[model samples]
Target: MVVYQSNSTNKRSRGFRVRSLSHFAERRVQSQKLPSHEDTYPEPGKSKVTEEKPRETRDEWVISIKDKVNKARGDVTASTWDKLCIYRVPHYLQEDDKKSYFPQTVSLGPYHHGKEHLLPMECHKWRAVNMVLEHTKKGIETYVDAMKNLEETARACYQGPICMSSNEFTEVLFLDGCFVLELFRGTKEGFTEIGYAPNDPVFAMGGLMHSIQRDMVMLENQLPLFVLDKLLELQPDTVYQPGLVAQLAVKFFAQLMPTGEELTKMDKVESVDLVGDNGELHCLDVFHRSLFKSTRTPDGKSLKKSMSSRKQQLIHCVTELKGAGVKFRRKKTDKLWDIEFKKGYLKIPKLLIHDSTKSLFSNLIAFEQCHANSSNDITSYVIFMDNLINSAEDVSYLHHCGIIEHWLGSDFEVADLFNRLCKEVVFDPRDSYLSKLSGEVNRYYSRKWNSLKATLRHKYFNNPWAYFSFSAALVLLILTLVQSFFAVYAYYKPSS
Candidate 1:
């Protein structure tokens, strides 16, 4: 019985091994007969999958990559929203002078938003927002909702991506927008009424107010004009007064204006009606427009002439001009950019330079450089000043002429300020109104006789004593020449 069982087991094992080999052979045959993935899944419209293309050569690969890059760039540009019209301070300008381009007292936009140094102002911002909410009797949610509508548009106003989430960005817009509106109102109304301590450093204090003003006008420290407009529209005051925001803003920045007299004249003539509609980009833009409006005469033809007459040119510095007998005098105009040259006299309007002056000019010049179709008037003025003030003596000369009224300690500081202000500044000197003025000044300077006359006067007639001595010497020389002539005549007369 055992022998029969062992023989049956061996037969079963042999049968199982035979079945496995047959199954494997059948699978191999089936796989060989079946189609490949390419053949099975041919392109829908084609009969067969196309053959794989050959690998590209190195040069071909480079060209293909370049084309893809260019195409991607074009797509990105096309898909991008309208250019923000905001820009970072050029790196070249910031390398040597970072403070002028950066905000110091407060942060307004996302770029410097929540910085450690600027955190102190966050409390003030919140307080300002709260004051606005309380005054308007509107909840913060209203502002948040309104800004939410403007979120995408406001984001596009900045030059680059804002790293915050949409909700965070909207909240920032609400807080900062309210804060700015409330701050501007505070200046109009008292800071104490706007929920600030009487001694609040940023808004109420004396010295710090100037710094905050300087910071608020920085390119990096600007808010979207639409955000400000939205907030302004929601104000109850706008119902009673159409341009309450513009009036408040104009009043707030009145003291800091470059040309206060002109602004006042403009207020009388135009009534601040051009504030929101005149293509102002932000607070600085509003301020800039006020200047433009103020400086122009009522006829508007003067502005046309000023704009058309810009011819970029370079002129001599103060020292060289002095040597060429070019006189420096203060032109009694409220406009800072109005400089004139006539009859060997260079008339620069009185410039009040304070600690904030450098920061102000730097940002204004930077704004001009960053924007398209922007006039380089401010930049050209800065460049012209920089060229004219080469040393402390130049600053002294301007100061003595009443052209420069600086709060700095020394003339050297003022000189250094102007000399360094336009360093790395982007400007087309030939495209500025200053160019025409400079051309005239340089033409006057180039007359060789003017320089010669200056030299002779300086050498022979600079002082009363020098004049007296020169006159005496001339008289003595004439007498000596006459005596010598008489002696020569007597000798040559042959005893006649």
Candidate 2:
């Protein structure tokens, strides 16, 4: 015990040195296990957790939205009290055009039953004998019944005759929905108080009839391909004969006109005619005479007075008609007395041309040429444009209709080409101007490239490699961008 105490300090110092050396060795091993600063901190803000964080998840937000949608569905279902809402499946969407809103009924032929006759073994003989015999037996009776029904319908829909003037010679009336220029044939005694008298006998019925016949003819001549197809479907034999149905339609339409002289005097000549073959009349000629009163420019002394007089007359006429509950309105384009009947307003263009006068023929021809050149089809846009240009009563009318666009300024050709290109890329929607233009351009290109691919494949048998080349080019472009990004980063990177 005495010897151990004497060396206590030295023993303590020896123990401390041994412990310190062992701790040093352990620390060295730990340091070797730990990552270096360069390895752990590649960039200042870089993360060290090798496994990526759950991408700062918005899973709760997504769940909330899903729950909200489910709740809405449940509410709608509950409120309806029906397991399925059948009507929610709309027949027509709002995006659909007006024409599409109406469901098309299946078209039936002349026979009331919707059936077509299939050819039999003895078809030619059966058709020649049986069809002819059947027609001879029933055609006249059927025609008479049809005419009677048509007359009844016309009477039911009658909107009273349009009275042009009180004078018997001047008065023209629209009766049974047909225009008639009457010449007074006779007078009634008691009717004098209501303005019917004897001396003013009517006479223009024949002329009016002639005019209607001409109008019908023009319409038949200008019938579009689609209309022809419909006509053929209704009367296949008539299509081959040509103008037969048109003539019949014109005659039927004429039957809608009033008989007698009082109806004929008011038939003003229209510029354009819709005459049927055999040159039968279909409608009155009124549009031409009323609009073009003179071909010569008015003398300075009378010009203002004439124009003023015309304007007043038109205004007065329209005002009187309006007062009488007529729906006719004086279009803003009118400089003089020009008014259009309102019922079946969409058909006004056709009707007006039917009633158009010879004075407007030149203008109509010009308009037709322009319209044909400008449009691939008789689209509504083209029709509207034609009306604007051809129907304008004066320069003021043209201005009022806002039809300046029809005049292709300096860039007409360019605009036309551009429109064609657009048409090539788009489909037609019939009435839509833009869609029609796009369709026209598409048609042009389609026709231009007809069978080109077939010819190429058959003649050379080479698969097109342009698409592959383009894809390869795109890949190379992406790699170049990545390489550029890395090169820039490397140049800007700090060195230790």
Candidate 3:
């Protein structure tokens, strides 16, 4: 400044400084409006954007609207909404237009109460397919009444010791709610004949009877035996008199039948009696006596003591029979007599002869003859045999058969008889049987699954491909964790 610079140079220097300051101020304002490059972008040499993309305003609005619409639709479909509409629809709408516009007034109609109403009458020709599937899945309970009636009709047309093959018998006889009785005729050659009563026709006629009883409690008024016979044509076996059989049948229908608890309680007040010609009483006393005697005594003294005494007497008799080498047949039968050396087999024959009622006097006479013919002292043999035959009636052939079958293979026939009887006689369902309730619960779940499938079919049948894709995506998501687990394991696994 002391040397005094040129005027032109000073003016130029001042101009340059002003321009530089203005440029700096403009840049500062621009930076305030738009962030600094470093703040908005990645570091140099890296990508310009981060992983997350900025959402669009249009998409946000659309999503918001969709969410609101879905929420409103859910409200409209709720049970509470239906209930409210039911009570308040008249107040909400004009009377003339209410029936057409209101939700409650819309005619959804009553639910179909029967399968027949579910499908058209013309469509019934194809119902066999549904019937077969339903039968297989739910079991034969529904069609049993119809089948029983058909069987009864078939039985009425047949006569003369009518016999059905085992398979046929199984179809007709083993159905639920049916009562069957199997009788075997024993001949000299073993059991040779079998019979069953109230064959197919009886079951058919009894259908209406069961239906009446099932539907109307008051309709269970007893019917006359003659009328029942005319309808059922039931023939009681010689062993089972009509009066006794009918009494048991009535007792079974009233008290012992497996029905709902309410029905059972109702039946309790009803008396079950059967009137028969000749005033002969068909008694259940014998059956009761047999059952009581077969039961083991609580004290255990009686049976053991009796068995011990019988064993000694049995051994002596078997020895005498063997020594004599008597070649004889069962008195009233043609079957050859057997004398077994084994104690168990030897004991069985003695037990059978002891309990038997046929030819009691003849058996005693034969024993006396055998003793006189033997070289051993005859007096002891005669007295022993006499007492054995007298008390033998108390010995239970069936009970002995049970014990024998447990220990030996000779009681197959006896076991078969018991099995048949058990199949015929139905019992009240017990807790043990009701353990299958869980299976029934599973069945209900299956029905729910079917209903869900039907609903899905109705709702999305037009968009099967889209539905399938959605389903596949959902499934893939569900299984993602599993795939990830395997992938992680593979990544960490050591090379073999």
User: Which candidate has the top score in lDDT?
Assistant: 1
Least well predicted 10-residue stretch by lDDT in candidate 1: 300-309
Error of 1 at 193 (Å): 4.5
lDDT of 3 by residue, 94-168 (tens): 232322221121111011112353223212212322433332453445344344454533333221122564335
How much lDDT does candidate 1 score? 0.74
TM-score winner between candidates 1 and 3:
1
Relative to the true structure, how large is the alpha-carbon lDDT of every model? 0.74, 0.29, 0.29
Q: How many backbone clashes does candidate 3 have?
A: 4
Error of 2 at 430 (Å): 22
Candidate 2's TM-score: 0.17
Please identify model 1 stretches exceeding 4 Å from their true place: 1-83, 193-195, 205-207, 239-247, 255-263, 267-275, 278-280, 292-313, 464-496
Which residue ranges in model 2 land beyond 4 Å of their true spot? 1-95, 98-103, 106-133, 136-244, 250-337, 340-496
Q: lDDT per residue, candidate 2, 1-496, as tens digits?
A: 8778868977999899999999998899798877778766688787665676665459876988999999989856645222110111122221222221111221111111122331121222222223332433434343333333333222222122212222211111111111110111111112233233333221123323343233322211111212222222333233344443333342333322211111122232122222222211122111211232221121211111110111110011212222233222234332122223333121112112212222123222222222211221222223323322322232233333332222223323323322222121111234233333334333433442434543444345445675576678899999999999999988899565
lDDT of 1 by residue, 1-496 (tens): 9999999999999999999999998899798887768788877787964587778888998999999999989868754445465678888777888998898788887889878998988988887777787788887778888999988777777777789999988888888888778767778777787667887776673747777778878888888776787887887755634455556666766666654234445452354666544323677666665555442333332322122324333676899999999989988877666677888889887777777787888787777767664556676677788889889999999889988888789999988887787766655666556676788888888999999999988777788999888889999999999999999999889684
TM-score of each model, in listed order: 0.74, 0.17, 0.15
Clash count per candidate: 2, 48, 4
